[model samples]
Target: MRLRTLLRSSSAVVLAPLLAGLVVLLLRADGTLHPVPGYGLSVLTAAHSALPYIAAACAGSAAWEGGRLKQGRVFEQAPARGRLGIALPVLAPVWLMGLGGYAVALVMAAVAADGTAPDLSRPPIPAVAALLLLAATLTGYLAGLVLPRLAAGPVALVGAFWVMAFPASWQTPWPRHLVGNPITGCCGVGQAVAPDTLWAAGIFTAAACAAALLTAHRATVGTAVTAVAVLALGTTLAAGFGQRMGYDGTVPRAAAELACDASARPRVCLWPETPGRTAVVAQIRTETGRLGAAGVPVPAALTQDPAGGPDTGVLGRTGELSPEEVTRTTAAALLPAPLGCEQPAREPLLGWLTAVATGEPPSDARVRAVLEQPRAAQSEWFRAGRDSLTDCGRSGVR
Candidate 1:
């Protein structure tokens, strides 16, 4: 069969409108779009989350195409191409159609970001969708070869949907993270898809596709045995990759790697998408200086350090923080409340710090009383309360 003839087939015609409708529905349900930075990633995440439905449709369409081949008795006609050659023409356009859907979807997602350019780092999500389409289509083809088309089409669609959707609810990491349910919307301006997780999923889905191809092309017992062995090996290898979650926690490291502004004192750095970084940095520095002047220890640098631990006093997630919010949060960090204390008096130093950060006088009577105490008494209050506070009452800064 000529490529042109196959391209003009009924399968492509039917799938065109179906895919368009599905994509439209997905866009409508994609919820409100925030105008924060990393607009590209948020759009990609929405697209990634819709893959199971797209893949389900692909599986059904592929099964129908397979049935058409078997029903026409293409094998008996013995066209110029053998079984594999004939099947290739029937399958290629549909697979390409599925890939085309992702391309169109990527464009729509970019538009949905409301003028913000999405990160074009080529996330592994589209590749994952492509591999899943191949796996589902090939599996459907194998079924179509055995069962009648009427039964195979629906079965493959439902089965593929279940395979993709059910694992999302699984508690185990292998099924939850590796089973194709996207850990999407987690990647923001400063975050990325976990490379190890993406690689493992790619390996797993590729193995499944290969096995389906082998089963559809070779019916021999040896081929079947080999396919099962390959699948098992792939599964074992994927399991050993040790991915704890489907997506990595967002880190400011990606932003730090980008162009950093060092003009501010204490040299505050931020992600490109971080709103009002200079203002927030200035406010934080001022608040930290106030803390220091009040005899409270403050970190010299106020930056987002990916590797910094709790004691490092790292200011984080500047994209979400306002300038005043940063001031308050930084003040709290400099003089944090003790946990689980039964002390009756409010911690005067912390109240004063909060008052200074927010430009408000301390209102509570106990806090007011504590502020009137001598400097030594206030110091003793700070130290004594630190030990007396249990794990529950963390801060008395209100």
Candidate 2:
């Protein structure tokens, strides 16, 4: 079939509305990407966000095409082309339509990042997404060959969505990782998509596509056996690899050169993509100075980099930098780091420290009582609270 004819007749003609919907979804979903505009993160997020919709559309369209082929007896007629050749041309438009949607998503991500260059160090999420979509298309086409024409499209549509979406809710974290969803918690500036996650998705989707193709082409018995063995091996490896990843399929990103303001007493460092650095640095300096005057020990440096020392305080990784945000981060920095174990007794002290750092009155009655004491007495109590923060056994407030 000619390219023009295939496009005109294929479901790609009606995909405009779907693509438009995808664009809207991309824009709305990209709000979190705005603060950290790393291209690799943006691209990965866009691909995962767009996957469910694009996969459903591709699968449904391919199913319809498959039904049409079956109804026309294309397979039975022994046409000039073989089964694989005939199906490929018919399904080409659907596959290309899906790819077009992914392209649009990438463009939107780039736009969201204000055209920042991609972090090339990160895994190839977009490529993995393309492979995953190809597997979905083939799976749907296979469904059409077996089911009644009226049932194939709807079945493929629902099944594709379920496969892409349902795993996210599973108690077992690995299943979601194996699917093309990537990771939702992915990619603060300090994080990257785990390489194992990409490998798992790639392996599974590639295996699925190969199996579907072999079946569609009517392989010999020996070929079928080989394909099944390969499929099983791929599944085992993908699942094992995915199980080892964190729930969100991310890892601490490798260190990169940061933008730092060295003029301040405690140097302030941030990701290069962070906006309004001058304002952020000023706020940090002002807040830290106030805390120091109040007898709180300030760190030697404030950095947003994940690899910074325990003594170094961290700034917020997302959102616009503001005075309130700076004050909160600075105050929290003065406190002991969370031990992950609960320490409810520390709430009053935490509240008091935050109030002092921000120059706000304490809201809690217990904290207010502490503030009413003389400056020397209050400092004693504050020092005790800071020192005992990690002592979970000390349930009584000082």
Candidate 3:
């Protein structure tokens, strides 16, 4: 009976955040996601942006568990002190243990689930864990209100973990917005989704909380009610947030236009416009090194005529020092008539090892290594540019 009660207790814990994650996925799935060049910008950017919400999702689970206590369906039972007795031996231990497991499970699922848009890689494990804890703290208070001293907590937690394992719908109303909230999920879409999604999600969350608060004050909380309310909250959060974060339209027309004019492959054109061609050339160099070899396939013009054409890798690695050797080599190839480094369309002038070794000094490398990067543009190239400066007498490699 104890085990059964505990199992039942965990329901809300897992359900809320998982639903929230699902909501984000659903919302963002329909939007535009340009492949930000081979610098891997789009993918990397998506990854970093996604972590905060994942943390929130983890928290949603914890919150769901706590809601039982706060709302007095279970955890708050016993003769005051008796509640502590129940908690130390059974509730608190289980709470911590289960939370760890559920958090790891959810994060692993997210990391493995998608690679295309939501970018599952950016969030560090620790940060996600912290967020999960925060969510749990809020949730625990609610769990206190409606659960039976012996039954509420375990049921909410176990159930919460379960919800995280599958795709679910989610929504929320105010007051208790903390439980079914979807605002965090909106972070996943980047700038792709509509701003209204925020208000929409917030309104729903406010309503849910209000109902939960009223139910608590009226002493109407129960196991069945716990299950229904939490499940509903989780599902709505997942579905609603999914809509907000999921991308919908075409890559901004500008993304396509840039790609076409790039004189490089479609990917080269895909990068956000802020980084200029020279910086792009630097990024190409870096990717080519990662991909290995110099003659990889690219756009046509770059191959046929040099001088920053889109064909065959870009001129220099984005983060590598401005290697005079590479720059000289590329400058010569693209304009052999003037600079004299061309070896024909089929062959590239530089090699992987050579490119890696190229960056020269004004100590550009030092600067790139230390500069702060913008949220979306935090790539090797951006870091490098922050470090780069032209200086006379010195080789231009820095």
Error of 3 at 268 (Å): 9.2
Cα lDDT tens digits, model 1, 1-398, are 67677777848567867786777667656473333445466566556655676677777778888899899998779856667777877887777767766666665566666555555576576677688778877877777788888998898789878887787666665654455554454566556566566667788888888888777776889989989998888877776553555334222345445434456445555565566665766677677666565566665455455454444455545467866567655654554343444544334555666765565667867666666778677656665544444434454333
Clash totals for all candidate models: 9, 0, 109
Q: How close is candidate 1 to the true structure, as a TM-score?
A: 0.83
Whole-model Cα lDDT of every candidate shown, in order? 0.65, 0.75, 0.37
Candidate 3 deviant stretches above 4 angstroms: 1-140, 162-165, 168-200, 217-398
Worst 10 residues of 3 by lDDT: 248-257
Off by over 4 Å in 1: 30-36, 246-255, 258-260, 309-312, 316-318, 335-352, 362-366, 374-398
| Cα RMSD to the true fold for all candidates | 4.1, 3.7, 18.0
Task: Give the Å error, residue 361, model 1.
Answer: 2.9
How far does residue 348 in candidate 3 sit from its true spot (Å)?
25
**Model 2: lowest-lDDT 10 consecutive positions:** 30-39
